[model samples]
Target chain A: MVADSLVAVTIRSLVLIIVLLTVFAYLMLFERKFLGWFHLRLGPNRTGPWGLAQPIADGVKMIFKEDIIPRDADRFIFKLAPVISLFVAFAAFAVIPVGPPLKIGNWTVPLSIADPNAGVLVLLAFTSLGVYGIALGGWASQSKYSLLGALRSTAQMISYELTMGMSLVGVILLAGSLRLSDIVTAQESLWFIVRQPVGFILFFISVVAEVNRVPFDLPEAETELVAGYHTEYSGMRFAMFAIAEYVNMITVSSLVTLLYLGGWRGPAFLPPVVWFLLKVSFFVFLFIWMRATLPRLRYDRLMAFGWKVMLPVAFLNLVATAAWVAFR
Target chain B: MATRSPEYFTHQGYEVLETLDGDRMILSVGPHHPSTHGVLRLILELEGETVVRCTPEIGFLHTGIEKTAENLTWQQAITVIDRMDYLSPLSNNLGYVLAVEKLLGLEVPPRAVTVRLLLAELMRIASHLVWLGTTGLDLGVQSMIMYAFDLREGILDMFEEVSGARMNPSYFRVGGLAADLTPEFERMLRDWLQRFPKRYEELRALMEENPIFLDRVRGVGAISQEDAIAWGLTGPNLRATGVSYDVRKAFPYMGYETYDFEVPVGTAGDTYDRYMVRVLEMWESYKLVQQALERLPDGPWQTDDRKIVRPPKHEVRESMEQLIHHFKIVSYGFDVPAGEVYVPIESPRGEFGVYLVSNGTNKPWRVRVRPPSFYNVMAIPKMLEGNLIADLVSVVATVDPVFGEVDR
Candidate 1:
C-alpha cells in the first residue's frame, strides 16, 4: 500500500527521471570513450579530466545553441516530435524494476516509479509508441532525407517489434506472470538465458533494431541519409532526440537484465543495485561493440532478414516455450 | 507554384519533382553532403528508395587549374598540377613533369627515375588507403577510417621529409626531383614498410570477414566489363570488372616495366570487387616500393644541362655564367621548343595524362590534364542503375572520385 501512495510515486518518478537523464548523459561519454579505445584513439579528453565533464559541457552547449524550425516545416509537429520521443523513452522506465523494493524502518519504497501487473506489456507499448515520434518528426521536417529515414524507421521498427514481443513470450510463459519483478524472481534459481537462449538472442537483435542502433541504424545513417530523421533539427530540439536515443538504450539494457539476466541477483558481497548496474552495463558495452564492428544492413536485406528469418524463429521459440510450460 | 500544369513540370525538367503526378522523390545528394567526397552533387530521382535517374552535377570545386597552369612557367606549373588529384599529388607531379621533360628533350638521371618510381608506388598505396577508409565509412564501419588514416600518416611523414610538405608536395621537377631523398625519408619508409602489411591485413580482415559488410557490398552497384570500358572507367574501377588494362603495364613510365609486381583484377564489377581490387593494388604497390628501394642507385638526381636544371646555389654565387643561367631560370624560366607533347603515366587513380603545348616562350601555350577521376565519375549513373540510395554511397566511395580532379 505504501508503494502505491501518490506522494511515493511522485517522489520516485522525480528521482528516477533525474537519475535516468544523468545516466543517459554519462552513458554517451562512456560510449565515446569506449568506442575511441576500440578505434585506437583518445576520445573526448579535452573537456574535463579524462572528459568526465564532457556530457555537462555538451548539455550547456546544446541549451545555448539556436533552435531553428525550417520555414517550410510543419511548425507545431516539428516542435512537438522530440518531446514525444523524450517522453516515451522516459515513460518506459516506470514499470522496469531496477532492484527489489527498499525497506526503511516500517516504510517500504518501490524502486520503480510504477508497479503494474502487466509491466512488460506496458514497457512494450511505450517502446512501440516511440515510432510515432520518429515517423512524425521526419514527415514534419519537410526534407526528403528525413522523410526517407522516417519511412525506413517506420518499416524497420514495426517489423522488429513483433519479433521482440514474441521473444519475450518465452520469458513470460516461463515466469507465468507479466510483472517484470516476477520475471526476475522466477530467475532466482536459473537465469532465463540458459533456458531461453534462442529467445535471448532474438530479443537482443530485435532490441538493437528497435532502438535503431548500428547495423540497424538506417534511420540516422549519416553517410547515406545525411543525418536522417533529425536532418533539419538543431540545438536543444536535436539534443532531445539524441537524449531520447541514449535513454532508450539504457531502458532496453535494463529490460534485458530484468528478463534474461538474473536482474539484481548476484553474489551476497555486493548490493542488489550494483549487480543490476553491472548487468545493464554489460549489455550497453555489447551494443557499443556491435556499433564499432558491424556495417549497416541494406534496407531491403534488413526487411527480408526480419520477415524470413527473425520472425519465423521467434514464433517457433514462443510456441515451443508454451508447449514446454504446458507439459511441465 | 502549386498551380503549375503537368506540361510545365515536364517542360522544366521538373517531371520527377511533380508531387501531384506520382510518388517520385528528388534528393539533391551533395555539394554539401558528408559522403560526396567533396563538392560533387548527384541529382537523384527516387521512386521509393531506388534511384530512377541520377544526374551528376560537377564543377563546384573548379579552380581553373588548367588555365592557371597556362600562366605559370612550364616547371612552375607543377604546383597547380599537384592540386588536381589532391589525394595523389606526387602522381600529378610525375605526369606534368614527364610531359614537360618530353617537350624539352631532356633526360633525367637514373637515380631520379628510381626515386620517382618509389614515390609513385608509395603514393598509390596512400591513395588506395583513403579509398578503402572512406568506403568503409560510407558502408557504416566507422572505425575503418581511423585505422586507415593512422597507417597513411606514416607515408605522409615520409613525404614531408622528402619535400618539406605532406599532401601536395610538388616534389617533382621538369628535369628531375626538387631535391634528393633525405636519409630520414628512407628510414621512415623502411619503418612504414615494416608496419604496413600487418595493419593492411587487419583492415582487409575487418572488411572481408564480416558477413554484414559482404551483404552490403556484394552484387550492389555492379557494372559490366563492357559498360566499364564504354564509360571510360580505369584504375580499380575498371580492374574490378575483370579488365587488365593498367597503364603501368601497357605503357611503362618511370621504368614501371622493371618493377616485379602483379596487377590485381576482379571478376565481378560490384562494390566488393572494386574494394578487393584496390586492396590488392595496395599490396602490389608495397612490393613495387620494396623493389625500387633495393635497386635505388647513387648518382645525380637532375640533368647536367644548366639550360634546363637550375644551377647549384654555390655555383650561381661564384660563376658569372652559372649566375645568368640560374637567374634566367628563376626569373623568366627556360623556354621550351615550339612543339607539343602528351605523356601519360599510371597514377593511382588511373592513367593520369598531361598534354603540354610549348610556344618557344617562357610560359606554356597550353597545359591540359587528363584527370582519371573525371572518367571514373562519368560511370556513376551507369553503376547506380536500379540500385538503392545506400548503394549510391558505396558506389561513389568505391569509385573514389576526387572532385578536385573531376572539376579541375
Candidate 2:
C-alpha cells in the first residue's frame, strides 16, 4: 500500500510542476492580450498566430540575455535568491487539491501531491517564506533601489499576510477541517463565497497585495524602484522571478477557488478540472483588470489600510462565522 | 544617453562610502526612472518611504538649441525652436515667429492670424492629451495611456493635413504661414469639434472620480498659492493655485484679445487640480478651435509684401519679377530691423516667451527662450518636501516638466 501511494505521489509531483509551469506562461500571455483590449491596442500579435507564441518568445529572449552581477553583490546569495523564490512559489501548491481522487484499476490516487491534515498551515508557511527570496535578493545585490524595493516588499508581505490568513479562518471554521479537500467538500451544498462574501472580498484584496500585483505593487514599482528587487537579476534569473510571480498568482487564485468558490464543483455539463480552471481564470482576469484600472497605493497608506481596515473586517467575519456555525 | 553626474556623498570616509547614517538611505530616482517623465534625475534622501529631501538635477537633454538658433537665419530658425518643447512644437513656433514679427513690425492678415490661432489651440489639446496619458501611466493606470493617445492620434492626423510633417511642422513663417490650408482641412477639424466633446466627457468619466485615482492624487501634492508664486510657478501650475494669470489674458497675441474663452483655474493647488486644469484647458482649446474655424475669413494666407513672404509658386513660375522676388526671399532671406523684442504667448505649458535680438542682418544676433517647463520644474522641490516618494512622482506628473524644454 505504501509503495503504491509513493508511486502515485511521484506521478502527481511531476504532473503538478509541468502543469503549473505551462499555466504560468499562458497566464502571462492572457494578461498582455487582455490588458491590450482594455487599452484599445494590439499586444504582441506578430510572434505567432494571434500572438499565441509570445510567451515562448519572451522565454527565449530572457534566457539568451546576459545575466550581470554587480561587483559589490554577495555572489552566493545573489545566485540563491531566485532559486528560493521559484521553489517556494511552486512549493505552495503542494497542499491544494486540483480535483477529486481518481480510481484506476485497483488503486485510488488523490490529485494533491501532499494531502497534509493542516493544509492551510502549509500554504501560509510557504507564503511567508516566499519573502526571504525577495529580501535576500535585494540585500545581496548591494543596489540601493533593490534594497528599498526589498524592504517595501517584505513589510507589505507581513502587513497583508495577517489579513490573508485571518480571512481564511472564517472559511475554515465553516468547513470544520484544516484539509483543503474538506474545504472544497464543505462548499458542495453552497459555496462559502455566498455566505462569507466579506471574507472573500478581504481575502481577494490581500491576495492582490501578497502576490505584488497592482495597487499593492509598490515593491516592484517600476516607476519608483526600477525593476524593484529583481533590478540586478537578469537572463534566466529574472525569468525565474517572473515565473515565480505568475505561479504565485495562479496558486492564490486556485486556493481562492478551492477554499471559497467551490473548486471543481459545477453542473453535469463540465468536468471537475475544467470547472476549477474556469474559477481560477476568473480571479486571474480580475487581477489583470485591476492592473489596468487602478494606481499603486502609497506604501504607508497600504500598511494602514491592511492593519486598521482589513484586519478588523476579517476578525468580524470570523466572529460572524463562529456565531452562525454555533446557532445552526 | 547617459547623463554623467559626479559621485554623491553626505561625507567622505572609508566606512562612510559603504554605509552612512545606517538608518537613512539615499536613493537616486532617475536620470533613468520610468516616472521622472524624461531624463530628470532626483537624488532623494529617504527616511524609509518618506522622502526627506528631493534635489532635482536637470540638463541631461541640453542640446544648446538657443545657441543653435543664433546661427540660423530668421526664416530658417523655426525648425530649431520646434524641437525644444517637442510636445507643443507649434507653440514654440508661434512664440519665436511672433518675436521676429515684433522686431520687423510686420502685419499678419486676418486669414493667417486666425489659422495660427486654430493650430495653436489644436497643439494645446495634443500636448495635454500626452500629459494626461503619461500621468495616468505613472500613477499605474495602464489603459489610460492607450485611450488618451488614441485622441492625440486624431489631432496629429489633422496636423499632417495642415502641415507636411506630423510632429515638428515648421508651417508658421515670420510674417504668416509656409503655405495655405488644405481644401478639406476645415472639414476634418469640424468633425473633430463635433466628436471630441463626447470623447472628453468619456475620458473624465473614466478616471476623474475613480476612487483609486482620487486616493493617489487628491490633496497629495498640495502646494499653497503663496508657495507657488514664491517659486515662480506659472501656467496651470500657478493657475491651479487659483491665480488667474494666463499670458493670453494678460498679454494677448494672435488676436487672442478678441477670442472669447475662459482660463480654467483651480482652488487647491494639488495634483488633482492640475489634472482638472489641463482637462478643462483641452475643452477651452476645443472651443477656441471652433470659434477660429467659424470666423476664418477669405484673404491671402501670407503677407502681401514680397520682402516678407515668397510669392505664390504659380506666380514665381509665370512672372519673371515674381520669380526674382521668390528667389531673393528664399535664398538671401529677409532681414529684421536692428532691435530687440520679447513676445510672451500662452503656450500649452504656461508662459512660453521668446526674446529676440536682431542686428539688421539675415540671421538673429541673439535668441533666448523662456521655456515654461524650466520654471515649473524649479518648483518641484517645494512641492515634494515632506511628502512620500509616491507623492513625489505625482508632483512631477502635475508639473509635466518636459526635460527637452527644461534643459534647452
Candidate 3:
C-alpha cells in the first residue's frame, strides 16, 4: 500500500515539474508577443509558425552560450545562486493542487504532491526565499551594478514582504485555516476576492513587487543597472535565473488563483484543471499588461510606498477582517 | 588602473561634491551604456544610491570634424559640417552655409529662404521627437519610443523627398538651396503636418500626467536660473530655467522675425521643467512649419550668380558658357572675400554657430563650430551631484546632449 501511494506521488511530482517548466518557457513567449503588440511591432515570428517554437530556440541558444565567471567573483556562491533560485521556485509548487482527487479501484490519489496543513505559510516562506537568489547572485558577481542590484533587492523584498504577509492574514482570518485547499474550499460559495477586496488588491500589488516585475523591477532595471544582479551570469546559469523568475510568476499567479479566484472551480461545461489554468492565465496577462503600460517607480519612492502606504493599508485590512470574523 | 580612496576622489576637485559624507563607490557609467545618449562617459562617486560626485569625461565620440572641415573647400565643407550634431543635420547645413553666405555678402532669394526656414523647423521637431522618445525610454515608459519614432519617420520621409537623403542631407548651399523643393515634399509635409498633432497628443497622454514619471523627474536634478546661466547652458536647457533666451527670437536668422511663435519657458529648472520646455518647443516648431508652408513663395531657387550657385543641368548642356561656368564652380569652387564671419542660429539643441575665416581662396582658412551640446554637457555635474543613480539617467535624458555635437 505504501509502494502504491509512493508511485502515485512520484508520478504527480514529475508531471507537476514538467508542466511548470513548460509553462515557464511559453510564458516568456507570451510576454514578448503581448509587449510587441502593445508597441506596434512584430514579435518573434521567424523560428516557427507564428513564433510557436521561439522559446525552444531561445532555450537552445541559452544552453549553447559561453558561461563566464568574473575573475574577482565568489565562484562557489555564484555557481550555487541560480540553482537555489530554480530549486526553490519549483519546490514551492508541491502543495498547489491543480484539480480534484481521483479514485483508482482501491485507493484515492490527491492531485497535488503534498497537501500540507500550513500550505499558506509554506507559500509565503518560499516566495520570501526568492530574494536570496537575486541577492546572492548580485553579491557573488563582484560587479558594482550587481552589488547595487543586490542591495536594492534586499531592501525592497523586506519592505514588501511585510505588506504581503499582512495582506494574507485577512484571507486567512476569513477562511479560518492555513491550508490553501481549505482556503479554496471556503471560496467555493463565493471567492475570497469578494469578501476581502482590499486584501486582494494589496496582495496583487505586493506580489507584483515580490516578483520583481515592472514598476518595482529596480534590481534589474536595464536603464540604470544594465542587467542588474545577474549582469555577469551567462549561458545556462543566466537561463536558470530567468526560468526561476517566470516560474515564480506562475506560482504566484496560482496562489492568487487558489486563494482568491476559486481555484479549480468554474461552470460545469469546462473541467476543473482547465478552469484553474484559465484563471491563472488571466492574472499572468494582467502582470504583462502592467509591464506594457506603466513605468518603473524610483527606488526611494518604491520603498516609501511600500512602508508608508502599503503597510498601513494592509494592516487596516487585517484588523477589519479580524473584527468581522470574531463578531460573526 | 590605480586604486583610489574616497579621499582621493574628493581631493581631485570634483566641484559638485559638497562634502564626502561616508563610504563612497566610484562607478563609471557609459561610453557604451544604453542611456548616456551615445559615447558620453560619467565617472560618478556614489554613497549607496546617492551620487556624491559626477565628472563627465567626453571626447569618446570626437571625429575631429572641425579639423576635417579645413581640408575641404567652402562649398565642399558643408558635407562634414552636417556630420556635427548629426540629429539636426539640416540645421548644421543651414548654419555653415549661412556663415559662408555672410562672408560672401550674398543675398539668398525669397524662395530659398522660405524653404530653408521650413526644413529647419521640421528638423527641430524631428530632433525633439528623438529626445522625447529616448528620455521616455530612459524613464522606463517603454512604448513612447515607438510612437515618437513613428512620427519622426514621416518627417524623415519628407527630407528624403527633398534631398534624396534621410539623415545628413546637406541640402542648404552657399547662396541658396541645393535644388527646388519637390511637390512630393510639399504633399508629404502637408500630410505629416495634419497628422503630427494627434500623434503628439498620444505621446503627451503617456507622460504629462503619469505619477511614476512625474515622481522620477520633478525636483530632481534642479538648477537655478543663475546657475544655469553661469554654466553657459542655452536652448531648452536654459529656457527651462525661465530665461526665455531663444536664439531664434534674440538673433532672428533666416527671416524668423516674420514668424510669430511663443518661446516656451519653465520655472522650476528641474528635469521635469526641461522636459516640459522641449515638449512645448515641438508644438511651437509645428506652428512655424504651418506658417512657413502657408507663405511658401515661388521664384528663383538660388541667387542668380553663376560664380557662386551652379547653373541648371539643362542650361549647362545647352550653352558652352553656362557649361564652363558650371565646370569652374564645381571644380574650383567660389572664393569668399578675405574676411571672417560667425553666424549664430537656433539649432534644435541650442545656439549652433559657424565661424568661418576665408583668406580670399576657394577653401576656408578656418572652420570652427560653436556646437550647443558642448555647452549643455558642461552642466552635468551641477545637476547630477546629490541625486540618485536613477536620477542621473533622468537628468542625462533631460539635458539632451548629442555626443556627436558635444565632442565635435
Each model's DockQ? Answer: 0.67, 0.55, 0.60
Model 3 misplaced regions, further than 4 Å: A1-4, A102-109, B1-22
In terms of TM-score, which candidate is strongest? 1
Candidate 1 global lDDT: 0.91
* Candidate 3 RMSD to the real structure: 2.2
Q: Candidate 2: where are CA atoms >4 Å away?
A: A1-4, B1-22
lDDT of 1 by residue, B1-408 (tens): 023354654675644455544676567788999999998888787889999888788889999999999999888888998999999999999988888888888889999999999999899999999988898888899899989999999999999999999999999998899999999888899999999989999999999999999998899899999999998888889999999999999988788887799999999899999998999999999999999999999999988899998888899899999999988898988899999999988888888888989889989999888888999998999989789998998999999999999999
- The candidate, 1 or 2, that scores higher on DockQ is 1
TM accuracy, model 2: 0.96
Rate residue B176 of model 3 by lDDT.
92
What is the docking quality class of candidate 1? medium
> lDDT per residue, candidate 2, B150-206, as tens digits?
988888888899887899999899889988899878788878788898888988877
Superposition error at A86 for model 1 (Å): 0.7
Estimate, for each residue in A1-328, the C-alpha lDDT of model 2 and write its tens digit. 3334666677888999999988898889989999988989787799999999998999899989999988889999999999999999989999888889877676677788887889999999998999999999998999888888899999999999999989899999999999999899999899999989999999999999999999899989877778889999999999999999999999999999998899999996998988988999999999999998988888888989999999999888888889999999
TM-score rank, highest first?
1, 3, 2
- Model 1 TM-score relative to the real fold: 0.98
Candidate 2 docking band: medium
Kindly give the stretch of ten consecutive residues in candidate 2 chain B with the minimal lDDT sum. B10-19
